[model samples]
Target: MIITTSTAGRCPTCGAATVSVDDAEPWCAGCEWNLDAYDRQRRAPEFGWAWVDRWSHRLGYRLTRRQFTHLAGRPLGTGGRSAAAMVTAGVSVLLIGAVLALAVTGVWLIVAFPFPNVAVLLGVALLGLAVALRPRFGRLDPELEVLSADRAPELFALVDEVAAAIGTPRPQVIGVNGDLNAYATAVGLRRRRVLCLGLPWWGALSPPERVALLGHELGHFGNGDPRRMVLTQPAFTMLGSAADLVRPVDTVAGGGIIEMIGEALGKAFQWMLSRLLFGVHLVLVAVALRDSQRAEYLADEMSARVAGIDAATSLLDTALGHESVALAVRREMRAGHGPGRWRSAVAESRAAAGGRLSLLRQLSVREESSLFSSHPPSGLRRRMLAERPRHDPLVVLTEERAARIDAELAKEYEQIRRAVAWSG
Candidate 1:
């Protein structure tokens, strides 16, 4: 609960002791300086007990710091035995062994059968080459930004306020030059960072809505499980690469001579290796993604705990509204040969909408058939949000109250869209 002081205090700017709530701007009688600003700047420090209360209230479920640390920092493993590090090391050893075996076998086969064995060697070489080059093609540039001087003040202040309220460390704030979206990286050796992108539509979000979003990101940071995600990312990448390579092989082979030849010539070895790797990847991804959805749910709860569930819920409504508008614009642009400016607007609109919708879906849905989906179902998130108590403070910050914020955002998004359309 937030505490407000009933007694008037002296204003620092005006050096006036006589200041009351009755005054229009709460200025000091002696000096014309704004007392409200002074009070805000010089508010009394929060009590320790208050922090304890806030944290206890916010984290409805009992979780120890040790458990949080373990969840957030645990390494991925294979078959409940070898960790990701161990698996990586094991893969390296297997790769070396395979290379040695190929070299020895290739030389023998070339000496014995010449042509067929030579062809087999070439195929294996090409396959291995593709696997090695896969990383180069698949690298994803960090969609997140490192915080800069310009954004530091506002973003940091917001983080500090929210973090203090929730009794957690303020996460590092990063900006992305993308559509309306933000995500929190786990606490690393470096500070935890919350990445936000520049979305014209985001400008339309009310302060409460924005705070709710921030709260969600903070939830991820506080969970401290982002590190585990970071650790497991490589496994995901490898699995994806292997899957990509295998699909073409499976298509070409149709379980026939090519498959038989490949299998005889260590293609079977590679396939077995890939399957093992993929199995581990699948397990890690499932756990990580499930944890991610949980993080979102926890964040929603935390946001409600701090700002009120209503605020968080309204924020979702606004997000959905923005997505709907953006999608409409994209459909229009696709139909017409819109200008270059409109193209970016259309792209951004789609991204903002899509990202939020994806997040919402992830939170709501329990089962997903898509292997590539990184988030839970939105319907589930909405349901969870809806289930919270009506008296929740966040609920008080209704969607109806967010109209002006939404309008401002819509106008900005539309401006970009119109500019692009006109140019096109």
Candidate 2:
């Protein structure tokens, strides 16, 4: 049966009336089955400040952005640079102050105690425990194959060209090894940039769309989003440890009535402190998410400029089917296939899924739009791009250049495929 926007057939599993949400893919309303809704529900919060955290951030982000725009005499959607900076700075002050108060109190408890030696020992141990509880930001993925400009000049050259087109600095480090996703991360205290491209994702794209994809990533660099994360990221990490800071720590039972009462009071104080820290962390995260979404929109604008609106939008359209493409590749590999069939696998997957747009529409049905998401919904992005004014191309990719760049990365495709083999 021919399917139109409003006409969704009954569920195959359970024959019942189908319904669609937000013009997304249809599902059996009677059976309460919808693919997109299922995906959203899976990711949705079950309990504990999840809903509160997301909505708080949404509200805080909107309020801050609107106020900043008004004060700066800038149009809404111009950029989130100033507001994010302000929020980060303000949050840092509050966090620092809280840390200092805790430190001073800890010191006072040790020095003024009746048994100063025992108090000092306990205080030192507690300090050590707090430090130990801090989050480890070490390398989690050791399998990531790092690429250098010297080794992959063609890939690096493409990066440089895209950066130049978008007027941003090229990332210092490049890594290959992901399924169908590309991301940028800030490294070290200086926040040196590293760009990681997933080969399977890259291999599936046409030459022009590759430029669009790169442009979108480069746009994040231009937006200073990852770099700005340096402050808030660590603060959020420290806040995570605040729970341990205030946890009801039990001590030796034979300490006496005074010691027992002291322990009880201390436990209550720590609990209160933990709750306060949690509240602060939620507010900061919400504020950050607002700026994060703006960064995405700004990046999209940059992608449109560098790769043209059609290419930029099409890249997003293809991204919806990335998981499907990755799955197909994994299936082939398990059957003793090699890297040669990577592109063919992607093609077959897309064909079986009824093309990129159709797959995207299906995915969007369950892609519940949330402020907590770093990026805006794919459907909204498409609409935003369509409404944006057309501009001259910032970087134009000739067919030959695109093919040549692909040839350069051709050698690394096998390595990336093997690395991702275990990922799925």
Candidate 3:
């Protein structure tokens, strides 16, 4: 006689009633547990999947199971090696090139019979010195701690979550006393590391806003280009320093036959080297900047995926407004037009002009010289994000929730301002 048992029952753990059992033992094969024990474990938090769904609709594409897997499981350095490895490789290449150049020069000098060994030696020494100093100069400064003592726990939790999501190590957190701004620095492996959140950031931003900011920084970690900055930046600095040193030496030393020959060769070699290095640096910087910008976009998407797009957008807007107000105050001080009264006047002017201009553009134009811009214009960034497709499921909910939050925050801010004015 053959006995076949039907599989059926409710899972006590997750509260789904399609559980199965075999041989008189209570079990849920789907959830992988005995029905009795499964019922005792608490349910996980509701993921707010409805919000995510609405966002997916707004984004114009549903995240299929495969896509979701890709998002969650994809390594930070998906396309290639990590930033640290890339930097190490670049420096290695530079070293190899220097060695090859010296080898060729030595061979030519030996064969040609007329060339001075001293000149070739000097060239080799200079190259060696530059390579030797590369690591020291390239390393990023330690990140200044930016968060207040009180907010450290919250900040760490956010950093951990974002880091885990992006599959990069959580960066060292630092508190800075500055009134504005947060940045990541690639100080080399086992060194200062990434993600310095400003204290002002904590005071100014809400919890969701802070999460958005962390997502942005995580995007940087995901791209792994910060390490490139750590690697190449020192070479550029050393090259510039070498040029400065050589120029002054040539000027002070009169052109005796040896000096004249050395000067001529050195100047020519330096000129060509400078141009070549500068061109290479420029290309690399441009590529890095483009990647950095895209990283920001990706981060925004991730933040939306986790928290909701409206939260990310609101965070951007608030950060933008804070930046604008700070800029206005700085301009007033710089123009010798301050005394608190002028600051107030400038703030009023900024408010009247509206806060819709691209923050990235404003930051680049106002803060960075053209020679060292590591980011694209803010206007372009804003336009890209604004136009990009969003997930649809969370669209209505995200927009509605964001609007309500914004309105409430605006009211509170207004009241705070009024109270400050009254006190003053």
Residue-level lDDT tens digits of model 2 in 80-150: 45676577666655665665555665676677777648777776665555455443344424666788777
Clashing pairs in 2: 36-366, 37-366, 57-286
RMSD of each: 20.2, 6.8, 21.2
> Over all chains combined, what TM-score does candidate 3 have?
0.50
Model 2 vs truth, CA RMSD? 6.8
- Per-candidate TM-score against the hidden true structure: 0.47, 0.72, 0.50
Clashes of each: 22, 3, 37
On lDDT, the stronger of 2 and 3 is 2
Superposed Cα deviation of residue 345, candidate 2 (Å) = 4.2
The parts of candidate 1 lying over 4 Å away from their true place are 1-152, 186-192, 226-264, 320-323, 328-374, 389-424
Where is the poorest 10-residue window by lDDT in model 1? 57-66
lDDT digits (tens) for residues 1-424 of candidate 1: 1112224666666554643331222444444343213122222322236554334322311221122334332221112422433454454345445545656554555455556666667655755544452322122236544555453455555656667766656655555433545565543423445555444334434556666776666666665342334443444455555655553253344587886776666766667777776666565554444444445556766676666766677666555555454554455544552223333454455465553443333322222212223443344445466665544442233444344433433434454455546665
What's the ranking of the predictions by TM-score, best on top? Answer: 2, 3, 1
